[model samples]
Target: MVKKTIHEINARIRDGSVNVVTAEEMVNIVGELGPEGASREVDVVTTGTFGAMCSSGVWFNFGHSEPPIKMQKVWMNDVEAYTGVAAVDAYMGATQLSESQGMDYGGAHVIEDLLRGKSVDVHAISHGTDCYPRKVLDTSLSLDDMNQAIMINPRNAYQKYNAATNSSKQTIHTYMGSLLPRLGNVTYSGAGVLSPLSNDPEYLTIGTGTRIFLGGAQGYIVGQGTQHASAGMFGTLMVQGDLKKMSPDYIRAANFTGYGTSLYVGMGIPIPVLDERIAQATAVRDADITTSILDYSVPSRDRPVLRKVTYEELRSGHVELEGREVATSSLSSFKRARAIASELRDWISRGDFFVSMPVERLPGNTSSHAMKETEGVSFVSDIMSVSVVTIEKDASVYKAAKIIMETAFNHLPVVSKDNVLVGIVTAWDISKAVSQNKFDLVEDIMTRKVITARGDEQVAVVARRLDQHGVSALPVVNGGNHVVGIITSDDISKLFARRH
Candidate 1:
């Protein structure tokens, strides 16, 4: 049994005698010396993770002008910021897109530009008040010009995150990244063995007021993150740091093709080895941590878990799913993560940084639950028409056109011989086929990548699918992929009309 205290660790750090090592190095040290011996020798273990954190933002106060206007609307580098707090203070979220540049530029870019010493155009509009009468303001400002610039992230440093793969035939662009069709690729985030929360799974040394390395600058943990679920193994942290002191190398901007923009944050946490338990926790390996592989193709609040795999398998550049080998990739940079941990380790060894015990431990055994809607709410099965008109993929285009004209339905679901949904055909597709004089099989003119809904899904989820894909209808299917019914926009409109 070995025991120490934060006071002893601080004294050693101040005297430049603290023995600090990165989490990656601690693994080997523990294997050689055991947890008790390692606890006696290692004073602190440094951990790091670098990846896209969407719930991040910067809040700044633009010093009042001579004709100070109470900014009601604000834009930095053409991106909007929330200005409901004060006269000139505004908070810019990382995912907000630019009005003119769209996804090419965003709030994350503005924050990175400010860190790089670039001047951004600042424009604001305000109602003329008695004291502050200026109605408009247009100026150029730098990070130094702001009275205070602070990065307040709502959530960061996920303990362990699920891997994502798509089972649909069409590729999907999401915040998780672009998932290839049919589980062609698997993408996971987090620095497996070097993640901050992974080293302190129980939040023993990392909690409120815990000092941390945030974006190459010192930061503090504020409180529990928004969606902290310890029981689910998806814990998070809320942190704040000085934006002016951050380095561009540690704070960068990124865009996910169709998923707007986000900020790539470099963060590190140092855990004090107060006992053998703490040392053992810090020495966790990738193979010891496991996460579920979730199907991202499902458009709902709850997605099906494909399987559970350890980080070792996920980092090997491939994973086995249902006997199929799928290529793997990492959105988080492990190289930068190692660099961050090494930098923190050097800072502690040189007496430039000291570890502190948390004021209060974080909550444990908590779980996140899905939002509950009103009882007896409508589902796709409630609003869908049971008499679904379908056509075989091998049916003639003339036959599909005849069915469409007779039923007055614009869309027809194309199914396989086993009565499973395979594709869909529209009136326009049949018209084009007839005009082009290519009245071939329905499979030739049908859309292979069909968007579908499940009978058990909520109506609102199905409605979002219809709007997201710009389609007018969806075929509701069963667990076996059998088309049970069809839901259309008209059915939703009628439901809304009756409810109101």
Candidate 2:
């Protein structure tokens, strides 16, 4: 049960004696040899993910022109690049859509073309300076011609993500992919066992400054990503690498019809077999990770949760929802993920790649808050029906039954002579009164206990009271118990429907 140092593993890799395996393989190894024996035998466990990463881009230092012009604006292959840096530096974001081709092409395509050794048209305009007299420049540039080309992503490799489905009557076009209406299909976006953060679980050995294989090139974790929920059920990281060493096959441009453009990133991480804990972490399986199935049609931050499912069920290609089996599709490429893991393992075995300790640890207790609406909360007064039909306490049971049938309402507020809410009379009450031959006043048959809501109260609070009381509606009352309006389940549904 000896803990091996990273240096000793690197030495073994140099001598071609290191035992390297993919994260998927580590599961069986740990089960066969147990954590201690597996940790001693295994040098590194490689993990990978190949998915659409929109927060990806490459910054290039295109060498200064003969009559240098500070690039105030830039476009490569019709895709705009941010030229706000220096005179010759520019950043091309993956999701920046092509101006001419719309969603069909973008800056991600420019990166892929550049990596493929193909030239791209570069156009720039600048406010001419004394040292740089050129006002504009139109030219074609290749990767080899750039002074420096580096891929720096603010976010990539999400640890875990929910599978999405549409529970409503309309299809939903989202970043998760198209969710067919009424749970026609489910879409998930993770490599399960091959996902880097899934294998690492806790930040453990993988964190800021850790070396990794980024888009076919060696890279380092820069920091916590935009939504790096470490205390989250899943984990994530931001990464950077030299684009000069990457290949076109590992990085490609993607246009998702209505969803604009993004980069198909190929990434891999090597987990050092330092201890039994490390080995056990690397052996995490798809069945162990769970994610919720969200109804994307809700169109709110608090989207409805349909169900919770494991990655193993997600990978099975279908999941059951609403008593029907719905087909599932993956937004991530498992084949490419396996290939990247295998390639990373080869690099570590040949001493071409080495793991590094994190420069900084990710915060473990950070939590996310939902975005609040700018407008004030809606109250029951706004949505309640003002023209409420009521039955007087002195009204006959036959009269109350007639009013309920004509309005198609299940219940009616029973009011006193001065228009104050006395009780509630339902259609069932009148029917029971008639069956008992007690065709007297409505108050005699009505339920004396009435659930009432104040008009100034929040709609959510009123809705909760209706649910708690197991009632379909609540009589909205002003000061002194005067019935002003009526709030019903239908009203709440309509309110949320409009908001969504």
Candidate 3:
């Protein structure tokens, strides 16, 4: 378990508390609690319109690794997080996910770092979930032509958009996971509109309790045709000049690629939190492995849910809130991204485009909870150790190193015959033990008050503390202080860097 400060926080700070911050007592902390640098959830993707195309069927061709793309999750000035395409083709067609399988960057945006520009997020996307791996950086060429070239490709990007397509309330309820009585601010938007084509009452709008913040603004009621499964069906999202300039491939991809699977577009208003409002969604998710695995696991076997958010409250992050500046930029940004996509697709004809991103080390398995795949992985059960070390209090340095070299472990637990963990003997501790030379027992050189991880706690929280403490390994212990397993920095490094 991560031990709290033994001294007061102020005292710890005075004695070099690394990056600890004073507790917040200001106005309510806005935004969800994201990791240090990854708190900022607003991402504005402005696809430029480019007119270029390539012959069909050159699928899976990574044209180059140039102009790497990236997404930034801005949290605090110093404590923020980011991730980008470390290596092109490392995670084939599957969407690259960090330990956390939350959405940050999707398609072409994945290659942004190589093509870093003004509009690119000021920070990293927090997780290097590379999707459309672009070419590596080509300093010899300009990014303008390169980006345009990529957008012109007709390769269908894997999107999880689940927007409304039919006037059928069924589609709305399915995607929204709830019911909205009206569309937008208009009265009777969902169940009220009559479809001329179907000659039936169309729930063309969102049902109750389903509030999707797509445009930069919230509470928008999109027309039926706009939300169809077809690309550009949601109408053109306004964006920069370049994407609109490339039309054909953009449109073709949209026409072929299914509308994204998510309920809404705004980044800040993450859907998982809102989905909990559907009552027992979390519990239902937990009960089934498949349900737990799906980031957007829907069509659950539970009872129906309803959306109860108001335009004002959702936009402003308040309930029954009055006169607050609604942060609809998340929605607005999506609209712009969509518009740019449409225009870019309109500009290009059907062909393939090549975007490039750099090759960073693929993230290895790590103890950081953030690194755990949201669905498949959860709490780390036990870190596999090549060897373990158990030492007596009087074990000599030579004996310890000899033991270490034999077992392939750099650290050992020092215990008495009674098996009480009194201290730890480490490679670093051995260095000390040797210098002192007079030491006869492991305790002579060991560090006391051993740091550890609880078996039941999440990995990310424990891993962060291990990093903060500059410790190489932590003992996994039970409430009774019985050592069960050990986690080393090498384990984390191997997990994240994949260097093992």
Instruction: Give the number of the best model, judged by lDDT.
Output: 1
For all candidates, the clash counts are 0, 0, 119
- From the highest TM-score down, the ranking of the candidates is 1, 2, 3
Which regions in candidate 2 have their CA more than 4 angstroms from the true location?
370-500
Positional deviation of 152 in candidate 1, in angstroms?
Answer: 0.9
lDDT of 1 by residue, 1-500 (tens): 99999999999999888999999999999999999999999999999999999999999999998788999999998999999998999999999999999999999999999999999999999987988799999999999999999999999999989899999888998888999999989999999999988898888999999999999999999978889998877899999999999999999999998789999999999999999999999999999999999999887667899999999999999999989899999999999999999999999999889898889888977787888767567889999998989999999999999999999578899999999999999999999999999889999999988888888888987888899899998988898888899999999999988888
Put down candidate 2 lDDT per residue, 382-469, tens digits, no spaces.
9998889998899999899889888967779989989999999887788898899998988788988898888877888788768867
Q: How close is every model to the real structure, measured as TM-score?
A: 0.92, 0.75, 0.28
lDDT ranking from best candidate downward: 1, 2, 3
User: Deviation in angstroms for 284 in model 3?
Assistant: 26
Weakest 10 consecutive residues of candidate 1 by summed lDDT: 368-377
Q: Between which residue pairs do clashes occur in model 2?
A: none
Give me the displacement of residue 464 in model 2, in angstroms. Answer: 31
RMSD of each: 2.5, 11.1, 23.3
Candidate 3, which segments miss by more than 4 Å at Cα? 1-203, 206-410, 415-423, 438-444, 448-474, 485-500
Whole-model Cα lDDT per candidate? 0.93, 0.88, 0.31
Model 1 lDDT vs. the true structure? 0.93
Cα shift from native, residue 416, model 1 (Å): 6.1
Better of 1 and 2 by TM-score: 1
